[model samples]
Every structure is written in structure tokens, then in C-alpha cells.
Target: MKNELNRNYSEVTEFILLGFRTSPEVQIPLFLLFLLIYMVIVAGNISMLVVIKTDSRLHTPMYFFLRNLSYLDLCYSTVIAPKTLATFLSRGKQISYNGCATQFFFFALFIGTEGFLLAVMAYDRFSAIRSPFLYTVCMSQKACVRLVIGSYICGCINSMIQTGFTFSLRFCGENRLDHFFCDVPALIKISCVDTFVNEIILFILSALIIITTTAVILVSYAYILSTVLKIPSTCGRNKTFSTCSSHITVVSLFYGTVFFMYAQPGAISSPEKSKIIAVFYTLIIPMLNPLIYSLRNREVKNAVKRILFRKKSFH
Candidate 1:
């Protein structure tokens, strides 16, 4: 009841995001750097989406998930990158309460969707490698569509819960968020009321999302690895491993940073360290996804080559 009373007297209308407290000399340079990264993230993800859509040969269950992943990365980058860039360029980095809440919602939505999608992709690989003959029947068009839709639904549900709980807290004073964006942990840190319930909810949700996804990915890869080892020819084994390696690399990069950020005790979290880690997953990873997939996956490379050849011929 006291908590309810505290909530009734909410005070903060806006938050000033103290984004990366760097020297004045470096602010412009930092802004330019992030602006460049944002542009690359946009171009790379869009190109991958276009290439996958246009090339009939690329329209498999794998590429279907890849297309969704690209779209997620695109949206994810937009949620954080532009705001971070603006903070670097401008003197005042104030975000209205509504604006902050909206950012947190989409950020949670896309991040959760990506986590689920990565697990789904791992399962897709497992089916392809372990049950080659049954791969088509296993990952049918309807099944693929359902999996993608399910990911989005899960993301929406999780984000709604997270956003609701985080915003319910009464943030009365100290509206200065010591992070580049309005993340849940950052918001919870500033609330005047007891946030024990919010923290428990955050921990449980993070554990469920991170653990379940990581477990699925690990189990899928375990079976995948066993199946790959059983292949007779060394060349075939190498090719199979190559196909799985890109996904593994990306998963490692993403899950490592995210787990450290959310899964740890908030008392141990340093805003400076969190900001750097956030930059990696939120900005660098999205830009790197296309490069990693395209450079490593032979089919994507060939598709890009084909598209370029056709364009050159036309010109």
C-alpha cells in the first residue's frame, strides 16, 4: 500500500541521459564514428535482405531466418544508434518520459526477438545437418513461417511485461539516467521506491530468456557437432563445420555481452563498462552480422556476385 502511495506521487517527467562522459575534444569524433557505424549497419542489413529476397536460390529455411535476423538487426540499430549519436553531437541529452518508455519497449522487443531467432536458426542448422534427408519435411515452409511468427509473439509478450514492471516504479527525483539509452536496469536504478519486486522480475525474465535460448542453441549444436563428426569425408566435415561456425561466432558475440550485462548483479555493473558492452551488441554486432554471414557463407557470396554480374551486364 505504501508502494502504491509512492507510485501515485510520480515526479520525473523526463530523463537526461548522461551518454558516455567523454572529453569535449572527442565528442565530435565519437559522433562521427557512431554515425559511420549506423550507416554501415543500415546498408549492410538492407543489402542482405534484398539479396535474400531477390535470389530464388537463397530462399531456404536458413535464409528465411536470416532475412528475419537482418530485419531485427536493422530495427535494433535504429532504436539505440540514432539516440546515442544525437547525445554525442548535442549538449542536452534529455528524453521525455514517454520517449524513454517507448525506446525501452522497442529495444526489449527486438533484443528478445533476436535471441529467440538465433535459437531458431540453430535448430534449423541442426535439422539440415543431422537429418539431411528429412530436412525439407522438418523445416517446411509453414513450419518456418510459424517459427518466425512465434519469435515475434514471444518478444512482444516479454517486452510488455518488462516495460510494464519497469515503468510502474515511481521515479520521483534524480532523473539523470547514467547510460546512453533507457534500459530497464538503468531505470530501476533511479527509482525512489523499493525495487526488490522489479529486480526479481527482471532477473527471472533475463534468466528465462537467456538460459532457454542458450540451452536450445547448445543442444542443437551438440547434435550438429556429433552428426558432423560422423561424416566419412574430411572435406565434407570441413564444409559442414564452416556452415555452422558463422552462427556460432555471432551467437557467442551476442550472448556473451548480453549475459554479462543483464545476468549479473546490478551492484557490480559499472555504467562505463555497460555502455561499452551495449555499444558492441547494439551497434557493432548488427553491422558485423551481414559481413560475417556474407563473407563466411558461400551461397551468400555467390548470390551477391550473381547480382553484381547482372547489374554490370545491364549497365
Candidate 2:
């Protein structure tokens, strides 16, 4: 009876995140593992940013976008990693109502902005490869700055709408959120009122952003593929393909998971499965991004070597 009174929308003040439902013995292991992963996520992204900023050779539009990508990855992981780490160690996984809103807003902002930025990178690749002579004029530094600013602005506006859309609903129901973080689908699932309209609007807005960004990538790559096929020499073809390979790889990783989570209907059918997938894209992907770029891209490797040699010379 007392619980029922406290759970009403007027009275509810916090949410308890039910993290992973694994066995008790695994909690410590998971905690340790996530803590290490979070550390790597921070270190890797910061290193990427530092390398890009210091290396004069990396001062191109491509690396400019890459720099922002690392920044977003860092911000995205930090938003959830601390809270997630807390859930594993402590019994109290309670988050205030405002805290959840802040988390959702920032998460949505970075994720949304990153998606748009990838499309811009794709456009960058397309221009460089398809029209080398015009590439400089097309992707001039000032133009690149505007493009990035526009992406963030779009993300911020959409984030506000999505955040307001989700949090405006009454939560006179269960306070135990199934997932480790506050996400659109998860919050929608727990609303006390009729969420049919809210779900549609949210899904539509999310889909609009995903689909629009994806279209830019697809169209850009299609042109790129055609242009690449026309190159006569084998070595030339290989070089052209290599230029955009890292961008395409990251694009595939990001879009694949995002599409599965948001685009598909009835995604919340298996909460455990959703959580596992969420762990991959949200936490694991950020850690892998720096490694992916540094390992696969020849220029990044060269830059790291140059920086190390310079530091050694200084010492």
C-alpha cells in the first residue's frame, strides 16, 4: 500500500537501474571488466584527439571529422560508463529524475551528432576521390567548419525534442528500469499513460535522423564505388579503396547496431538480448574506434610514429 502511493507521478522522484541480471559471482568480474574498458575508452579517444591536433599532416577535413568522432566517442562513453560502473559495485543504483534527463539528452546529442558527422565524412571521401581537383574548393576549411556546426545544431534540436517527448510522460508505474541506461525505447516501455502516440512520434523522429544520414552515406558510397571501378590500374584502385576503407568500416559498425536497436519493431522483446547489443554499441564500440583507425589507417600510424620520435628527440 505504501509502495503504491509513492510510485505515482506526483510522488516518484527517482529510478532504480536494474543492470545486468547475471549471477552474483559475475558482478565483480563485470565491474572490473567494465572499469578497464572505460579507462581504455577514455585513454584511446584522448590519444586520438591529441595525435590529430598535434600532427600537421592530419589537419585535413578528413582528420577534422575524425577528431570530432573521437571527441563524441569519449563523451558518449563517459555519459554511461560512470553510472554503469556504479551499478555493478553498489546496491544503490538509484538516479534522480533530473539526472536521467541529463543523461538522455547528452547521450542522444552525441550519438545523433556522430551519425551526421559520419555522413559528412562520407561526402568528404566522395569529393576527394571523385573530384580531386575540386576537393579543396568543395571541402574548404571554412565549409567543413560550417558542416560540423550544422550537424551539432541539428543534433541538439532533435535531442531536445526527443528528451522532452520521452520525459513529459507520467511514470506512475514501475520505477525499476530494465536496462542499465535511460534510452528512448526503454523509457517508452515503462510509461504509465498511453504511449502509442508518443512511441510513434519518437520512432518517426529517430527514424528520420537515421534514415536521412544513412541515405547520404549510401548515395555517396554508390558514387564512390562507381568511380573506383572506373580506375584502370590495380594499384590505383587499391589506393582509392584504402582511402575510404576506415570510414566505411566504422559506418558499418555504427549503422548496423543502430538500425537493429531503433529501426526494428518490437526490439524490447528480449531485454537481456537488447542489453547485450547495447553494451556492444554503446560501450564496446567507443573503445574499439581508436584502435580501428590507428591500426587500419597508414597515416595515423605514421603520425603516431612521428610524434613518438619527436618526443624521444626532445627527451
lDDT of each prediction vs. the true structure? Answer: 0.92, 0.88
Instruction: Give the alpha carbon lDDT tens digit for every residue of 71-182 in model 2.
Output: 9999988999999999998798999989999999999999889999999999999889888999999999999999999989989988999899889977875778899998
Superposition error at 228 for model 1 (Å): 0.9
List clashing residue pairs in candidate 1: none
lDDT of 2: 0.88
**What TM-score would every model get versus the actual structure?**
0.96, 0.95
Estimate the Cα RMSD of every predicted model relative to the unseen true structure: 2.2, 2.5
Mark the regions of model 1 whose C-alpha exceeds 4 Å error after superposition: 1-10
Error of 1 at 222 (Å): 0.6
